[model samples]
Target: MANNFLRRVDLIFDQDCNFKDVLKSTYQRSNDDIINELLESGLKGRGGAGFPTALKWKFTSEQADVEKYIVCNADEGEPGTFKDREILFKVPLKVFGGMAICAKVINAKEGFLYLRGEYRFLLPELEKQLAQFQSILDELKIDFHIKIIMGSGAYICGEESALFESMEGGRGEPRNKPPYPTVSGFRKKPTVINNVETLVYSFMIFRYGAHKFKELGTADSRGSKVFSVSGDTPKPGIYELELGMTVEQFVEEFGDGDTKAVQVGGASGFCVPRKRFKDTIIGFEGVPTGGSMMLFNSSRSMYNVLHNYLEFFEEESCGQCTPCRVGCQQLKLGIEAVKRGERHATYLEQLQKLAQTMKITAKCGLGQSVANSFFSIVENFKEEMIY
Candidate 1:
């Protein structure tokens, strides 16, 4: 808890990197050396899932297939999340370098960056930096190369399997699991798909060494995360900070004086009311996020907040599974009914149960995680949801 204070870290945005130096240093290290460092550092997928980076690369590398792929999930469609766009904008090269390193670890000759459709403006500058990067790879004789592809702004496409489907010229829908991306991904080959910030941290871990990274944050959540702070905040912008801090500490720094609740993730994430702020830690040990921290003040309506998020989930659901597709619509309608006094407040208990069922039966993370915000808001702010 000593390190839980909101100390700002500048490793990702330092701009002190020379990709050649990082990659050249990488040239001397074997795949085991690279993977071992990642494992030691405990670097997880910063895309909110928190899967270990080392295992994704190691598992993909272990596949017998000769045609493995590495993908950067750049679909920044999560509501209240915009750090990925900033990372790509301010430090495109680091993102590329991170992908290159992963490509090497998995023996991948080709990598793809799935850029969000709205970020098309970045392609020109990204291409220039990428060409320069590939030339350096050519000079070093590294066998990796990367290409850029644009997304269609489907929120579900942010899921790894759905993104793969879109990349394969099919609809962006999530595939059933057990055969994850590491086993069968784009083209049904072995793949390692990491988020934009995840890749940047991978590169930074290599550049700064894993021990230094390990020294920060708690045991379960190692290293710093880039957070997109907005809504009822004095300082509403991107800030990289160490993990394991309570929501209270966060509100103290970023919250407007009248802050009432904080949405730790995005629309699909949990809503922490002011009462639980002191007890809630914003990490895997408590509530984990994909780096979207939206603060709401007392002036705002929790009912409206919950409504907006439910509507987003209802509209964005791919509608593949009944639990998710129908669940979202019913949840929205359920709350509306309660607000209008059309249903008894006790009906919310049934709706909460429905959300819990969706958590179990929903096919993808999109439908599954809706329960997080639903339960958190309804349980804590029950009065608002009713009247």
Candidate 2:
């Protein structure tokens, strides 16, 4: 079934075949031309925020610097978002190809794949692929070296700044923005940080040009999205589908059962009840997410699921700021209060208000978006929380 999905998308990954050929063919253009083509195609970042990839490259490339770097955020720490891991294990070379293209476009001499520590077993396979990719680069004379940096299993490290800190051998915690990674990153050099899937799309955009790629999905959100569909589903796995496909269509494709709600994005993603699912489209404009769809049945306890998510947030937060460190603690405690039926209704309301504040004022994405799962679940499934 997975193979069928890959074939449908023209993905060049399969069990019997390694991706050396795909990588070789994807690099058929000069760096400048590839950048121009990407800009013309209008490819946005695949990793949630949907920032323009070409503009990001242009900005990073224009920085007058002797040394620059491109870092792939392979730290797929988003709970229920396993697309990156699937790509790593299956179509690694395509990701490498995209990284190489990014390096060349941004004039970066080095690239790093900052993979999650939980993906330690895939490291040996990645190392082997990197060696082969090095040979491919040498054959093509592409003048850049890429390295794989394993994260220490911290969810905070998935944030670009924290990932940089982890790469630099520091405790994984976010730094202040304004000196965003592009301006000052990776040993204080100009850097381009992109998610793993975003880099893979870069390969496609440059290869087929932007227009062909844009034909797949919505005007605002052009191209297909890879989703890690799990939780209370008969066929739970990674699915690559066009953006703008309604949540209803998605569930139908997966052989619909009693889906009470669907969580878009990851643990930090929003929850849409069955009613809203029909209106929900899969893209930045709708959910503003990274395409991680986790379904929940009516039998599933919304309270229990929320509790599990809170536990994850508590463990994964980098303990950097008062908002994330203390805020997560308070949220967890509040959930516990609900579980034990000890909190007043007003306390839940207070927790919701605090989450909103964290979303607005938190220093980094971790704290800012960490409240999404809880708030969305609470808002959409209020009856479940009423005890």
Candidate 3:
């Protein structure tokens, strides 16, 4: 397990440019082979959902010959997820290379990096890196050019469809699914949207064989994952751990001695208390995360944590849909009411039921995932809310 523990795909991380030579070999192979390699690697999107990267590529590739686009979601809006920001700052070429490879597979001539507005400071340097990457594409004669699209600091735009809407110069509200991004996206063209880490992993998986990449992680979740650890951790920083490690293992390695609960994603993820940490695995099999692991010690207040998260979601909701806008408000108020003794304990039960309804009926992932942290924190630390 330790051998697979720190399996860093260091080609891009440490500025190893040898990946260009590896990509040159891919030009001779057919697109199907490349896509199939991704399929076999069992790589999933690192952007929370854990959707199959290969399937996204396959669907977009199989679409009718039209103007297709590849989008890299660099909108690192999640509270604790800054891994994408680091990748965008340091190893942008890996992102470009991955996008180029996806373009080659899906026959897309253009790509976009939807950068979060908070990261606008990194733009000047990123443009310089992209210019260098463009020359490499020119040398390889790959007919792909990546453009940078800056988001206006809207957290809802982190959703692919909302990002698409923002790219089109509209308000960033999520579109309904079924005609998902693969079929109709970004000006109604077939588009493939991947998070920053997912694109980098795609680059590595293509260079190293799928079997080699598959050797690292568990059966359910393949490949190593980059976790951004914070909050009461001794070593609070970015960690590249092989997926499927128990929460207990992670806490033991990084916790600041008195860790009591762990938030396994950002505000929109699950909270694992000390009792469940021993059995909890941080992967798709147990609790899948989009690269955030915030450890909370016993000193922290669960009510305050939930309040902070609720405040974030409340302000970030696009307000276009009633369920999200109104539901988030009610959740925040319900928790506050409980904390202040203004409402009976049964009020929380009503809010939980409402949260269940929101999960089923909300517009997109933002609204749907609000219940995750709400329920986890409230259910685990009920005493904190009441008294």
Top lDDT model: 1
Among the numbered candidates, top TM-score falls to 1
Steric clash pairs (candidate 2): 41-210
lDDT, candidate 1, 1-387, per-residue tens: 333488889888988788889988986899999999999999988999899999999999999999999999999898999999999989988998999999988889999999999889988988998898899988998888899999987899999999999998888889999799999998999999999999999999999999989998999999899999999998899999998889999988887789999999998888999999999999889999999999999989998998999999998899889999999999999999999999999999999999999999999999889999999999999999888
Question: Model 2 off-target regions past 4 Å?
Answer: 1-8, 12-32
What clash pairs does model 3 have?
none
At residue 327, candidate 2 shows an lDDT of 86
Query: What would the per-residue lDDT of candidate 2 be over residues 13-47, giving only the tens digit for each residue?
Result: 43443345545555665767777878877678876
Candidate 1 global lDDT: 0.92
lDDT tens digits by residue: candidate 3, 1-387: 343343444433756557578678877789989988999999999998999999999999999957999999999899899899888887888888889899998999999999999999999999999999888778988888999999988999999999999999999999989799999999989999999999999998878779877987899999888889899987787877788888888887888889999998899999999999889889999999999989899999999999999999999999988989999999999988887889999899999998898899999999999999989998999998899
Per-residue lDDT value at 25 in model 2 = 58
The predicted structure with the larger TM-score, 1 or 2, is 1
Off by over 4 Å in 3: 1-12
lDDT of 1 at 6: 87
Clashing pairs in 1: none
Q: What are the per-model numbers of colliding residue pairs?
A: 0, 1, 0
